[model samples]
Target: MSERYEYVPHHLLRRPVRDIATGVEGELMAVINENVSDAGREHWIELAYIRRTCGREFTTAISNVESVG
Candidate 1:
């Protein structure tokens, strides 16, 4: 399960997707906000939730996913 979730503006939730970096494919569950900083500035990172084909789940940057179909 994810720690935080947001139904991002785009219709990304509940959509099938794949992580090209890891090759894990599944449904997009949610988008979570992550705080990052560099040079005294904070940034929000959007992580997309994925339910792996093997019954596992995790969150990765939204840019890491691609439409499965």
Candidate 2:
């Protein structure tokens, strides 16, 4: 990992990545840390925000993506 990547705990914004399940490729636009509650329990999640070559955007679990660049 590069020094810049080491400092960024969970994201590589603007880097290219491919979705594991869908095989869709895109630029990683953002990393989102979210909290949610269910039945009095709290959960934390990390998301990969992406923009496809066709200009569409979406968020998926960070683990679902692999860096392509």
Candidate 3:
């Protein structure tokens, strides 16, 4: 089962879903995409959330997720 997610602003969460899904879905449809695994994909989604909420450096933000968890 998936872990519970905390609530977030609608504007913050909604944009990334639409934004990331657009690229993800397009790649899935064409079937030519490469370099992103399922775990990597999930990380990117989380990265979007990090970018939206923290406005910090992507590499730095991604590194800090381990501390949060």
Q: What is the C-alpha RMSD of each candidate to the true structure, in Å?
A: 4.9, 7.5, 14.3
29 Cα displacement, candidate 1 (Å): 0.4
- Using Cα atoms with residue i matched to residue i, what is each candidate's TM-score against the true structure? 0.70, 0.75, 0.16
Worst 10 residues of 3 by lDDT: 25-34
Ranking by TM-score: 2, 1, 3
Candidate with top TM-score is 2
lDDT of 3 by residue, 1-69 (tens): 233233223332223322232222110011111223454343222233333243432221211222110
Please, what is the whole-model Cα lDDT of each candidate in the order they appear? 0.77, 0.76, 0.25
- For model 2, what is the error of residue 61's alpha carbon versus the real structure, in angstroms, after optimal superposition? 1.0
Task: At residue 35, give the lDDT of candidate 3.
Answer: 28
* Candidate 2: residue pairs that collide: none
Residues 1-69 of candidate 2: C-alpha lDDT, one tens digit per residue = 112221125556788999887989999987776665466766667777789999999888888989986
Candidate 1, superposed: residue stretches over 4 Å from native: 1-7, 37-39
- Model 2, residue 29: C-alpha shift (Å): 0.5
